[model samples]
Structures are given as structure tokens and as C-alpha cells.
Target: MGSGDLNLLKSWNPKLVKNREKVWIKEQELLKENEILKQKQLEITKERELDSLVDPHHKHKNSKKNGLEWMYSDPTHNEDYLLGKKSLDSSVISKNNLKNDSKVDSKIDSEQTKKFDYSNDDPMSKFKIAKKRHIIQTKEKISKPTSPL
Candidate 1:
């Protein structure tokens, strides 16, 4: 080959080499990222497996209820029941106080009445309106003028 061809080859060769090196570096990075992702996926799967194994709900069907009770119940289980009763009593006292507070009671009554009114409204009426509007919009779109000539 002539010097011109040699020069051209030399110029092109470094670029090709650089391109190949870039591709190789990118592949390595991708491989590293893929490995990290795979490890994360493995960790997630291991966590799920461990969670399933440790979960009281996943115990043998016959033992599940007892396992759940044991897992969730306080260390001194009776204490929890007593505390629950105390909380119930406290709530009752608070409810009585609210009833005695005329302003609070009125507000609560108004809120409850509004909720009752909303509940009394037929839920299906909203669905029917939505369906009717959808049909009307669809028909309008379908019947829209195509073009002006």
C-alpha cells in the first residue's frame, strides 16, 4: 500500500481500537450492573423465603392459629387483655365527655347526619350517570364531522 493508504489505515486503526475499547468497557460495566442486579434479586428472593419460613401464618395449617396468637400476644399475655379493657374504658369516658360537650356533640351529630345522608344516596346513580356521559361522548366523537372540502 502507498503512504496515503498507510496513513489512512493508521488514522482509522486508532479510532477502531478506541471504539472496541469503549465497547469492551461498556460491556464490562453492563456485566457488573447485571451481577449487582442479580445479587439484589437473589437477596430479595432469600428475604422472601426467610420471611415465609419465619412467618407465623405460614406454619402448618393446624398450628397456624396457635402460632399467630403466640407471635402477636404480649409476653405477659394477660396484661394485654387488661390493657385493652382499660383502653376501652378510657374511650368510653372520652365518648361520654364528648356527649357532655354541647359544641363537640353538635359537630359530631352534624358530621354523622351528613355521612348518613351520603350513604342513603344510591351509589348506582353515579355509575349510571358516568355510563350515560361516556356513551354520549363516544357517540359525539363517532358522529363528528370528518373533513371540510
Candidate 2:
């Protein structure tokens, strides 16, 4: 209660004023608690709405076209990606780092292109088959001890 409220209470009997203050305080507390419960209900409803939208097992005839369905199958969102989470931080970075990354990416791409052979003699031959090495197991000679009767 503000000073104005207290000043208003002064016109009433002292005992009645005290009782009114207590009642006001209790009402204020209840109001705050009611607001908190309302906020919680809103949050629970939002979570349920999001769960309904983002179902992992949901698929369509034409490869799950658009929105939450497409986002569900995305490789980056495979685990622990919550849709309702806060936006990304606005941390500034040096332009030099980004430039270096682009240069490195271009170099890697060029190297990969050079390494890739387009010739396909056989469909199966295009895939490199790894030779299986034979592992020999050597048996250790165990000498039998003479049994004493």
C-alpha cells in the first residue's frame, strides 16, 4: 500500500484501520499468486501447442512438405532442439575469421573436386572395396604338470 492508502486509512478507527491493512496485504498476496498461476497455465498451453505441431514420426505422401514437418526431419534438429527457446545471442565477431573460413572452405572444395574420379567402369567398381586381412591365432603350448598320487 502506498502513503496515500495509509493516509486514507487514518480517517477510520485505529483498530479497524489495522484490520483493513492486513486484509489489503492478504488480497495483494492472493492477486500476485493468481497472476503466477495464470502465467503457468499460459506456458503449459504453449508447450502443448508446440508438441502438437512438432511430431517426429509424422510423414506425408510427398516427403513431409514445409513448416514443422520439414523441421522435424532436419539433420541439425535431430536432438535437444526446442522450438520455443530464446533467439541466438547477438555477439559480434571479427570479419577476418569469416574471411578465413570462406577461403579454407573453397580450398577444401577444390581439393575434393580434384580427387573425385568421374569414370565408372562398373557400378560396383566405383565403390572402393577394402581387402580383408586374415588374422592367424597362434596356440601357446601348455606343458602338463606330473600328477602326484
Candidate 3:
């Protein structure tokens, strides 16, 4: 072989060059996939932020929690309930329907209260009780008259 051909043969490493190409291809594919995922995440966050701007209360309204959470969290709903008015019942509703809705709400409330069975094994039960107790103690300390030292 000529000197030029021998130099080319000596410099060529096919296995290493092929491995490098494979690694580069894999890196490019991973980078492209990562960029696509970032774009989708940004789009989802933008949509959620826009919805929040349009209706700040949509989260509470659209949440999939059990019916219990709305009572303490929704001030408007609580006020409506205190006023003996169902959310769907307008001011122009007949007195009979109003009474019927109130009765239904009362029955549901009673049943829920009666069926609230917090077990000792419940992981959050102790925490909830402790939180309430701490709140009560703080309120009591705040309300109590301090002795003149």
C-alpha cells in the first residue's frame, strides 16, 4: 500500500466512530423529546393560569372532592345555606319548594354529621384533632383577660 493509504487506514477507527455517531444521535433525540415535553408543560400551565385569571373560584367549584369540603371553604354557599336558600333555588321560588330544599339540605347535613366515623387508624384524624385543639387554645389565650402583673 502507498504511504497515503497507510496513513488513512491508521487514522480510521470504524467502531469508535460508529459508537460516537450513535451517542450523538441518542443525545439529539433526547434533547428534542425534552423540548417537546417542556412546550407541552408550558402550554398546560398557561391554560391553567388563564382559567384562573378568568374565574378565580373555578378550582373550588370544579374540584372533585367529596361534598364535605365545600361547607367550610365556600363562604357564598355557607351564607346561602344560613339564609335557608339552596344555590339552585332563586329568590322567586315558591315557598313550598324552598321548604323542601331546606328540608333536603337539613336531612343530608344530619346524615353526614351522624355518619362521620373517624377511626383511630386514620392517619389524618389525629392531626386534624390536634389542629382544631391548637386553634381553640390560641383563641382562648387571645380572648382571656391578662392579669395585671
Candidate 4:
């Protein structure tokens, strides 16, 4: 009825203002929860990457599609056949259990393919260039015989 009471009533909404502080606190709590979930997701992704490097076969096993689709696809599923992976047999340092982390050796045989690319390894690129130069020189000599020299 007084001017002071009228001022308070005009500025206040019983439905919204009464729960405004509670809503703000809830929002802060949810933000913290979301951040924790994001951190967990990052950790999971890192772990999965490490697992993939250890064993490329196990890499896709934990995928979202593994749940129902995999179960129905092959009833007599051998894990190794399911993901066609052989043991590393060389390079990869297996820190995880060998049973869990299969080795990955991607050796490119010279006869098995076109150009034997030295994996673009910088250290070996110099040797590859030298070998190529030698081959070119030999061909040049053969094409234009250099008088028994």
C-alpha cells in the first residue's frame, strides 16, 4: 500500500525471481558437469588412439557400430578374422599386452609394388636420390657408349 512496498512488487515476479538464484546455481553446476564430460571424452579419444597404434585391428572394434551390427553380422566371429590383422612382427614398441596390442609392420617389398618409396623418411631420401642418380648415369653410359671407359 505504501510507495516502498509498491516499488518492490513492481520489480518482483513470484514465478521467475523466486527461482532465479536457484536457476543460476544450477546453470553453473551444469557447466562444470559438461566440462568434466568433455575432459572424459578427450581422455577416451587419446586412449583409443594409443590402442590403435598398438593394434590397428582393435582400433575399429570399439566403434559405435560394434554394438548390434557386429553381433548379427558374423555369429562365429573370430576376433582376428573379424579385423584381418597379423602381429606386428617388427618397429612398433608394444607397451600394452601383446594379446591386446598387435604389432604393425608395414614393410613395402621392392618387387611387390611400383616404386619402392622409402616411406618419405628424410634420412633415407638422400640415399634414394643417390641411388637414382647412379641408375641414370649407368643408363646414359649404356645409351652413348663411352669408348671402354
Which digits, one per residue and each the tens of the lDDT, describe model 1 over residues 12-36?
4644677679888999999999999
69-119: candidate 3 lDDT, tens digit per residue: 656442343455568675545553466466668877887797588657759
Which structure is stronger by TM-score: 1 or 2?
Answer: 1
lDDT of 4 by residue, 1-149 (tens): 55554444653553556567777889999999999999999999998788679768655444553457544332332445347775542333243344232322122232245455656668688789889999999998899956775
For all candidates in order, the CA lDDT equals 0.68, 0.57, 0.73, 0.62
Considering only N, C-alpha and C atoms within 3 Å, which residue pairs clash in candidate 2?
Answer: none
Question: TM-scores, in order shown?
Answer: 0.34, 0.30, 0.34, 0.32
Which residue pairs show backbone clashes in model 4?
88-103, 88-104
Taking all chains together, the TM-score of candidate 2 against the true structure is 0.30
Q: C-alpha displacement of 82 in model 2, angstroms?
A: 20
Q: lDDT of candidate 2 vs native?
A: 0.57
- In candidate 3, clashing pairs total 0
RMSD of each: 19.1, 20.5, 14.9, 13.0
TM-score winner between 2 and 3, please give it: 3
Residue runs of model 3 more than 4 Å from their true location after superposition:
1-15, 62-149
Residue lDDT tens for model 2, 37-92: 99999998997677558854333322433466554332442123246554443232
Candidate 2 vs candidate 4, TM-score winner? 4
- Stretches > 4 Å off in candidate 1: 1-15, 56-122, 125-149
Candidate 1 at 53: error in angstroms? 1.1
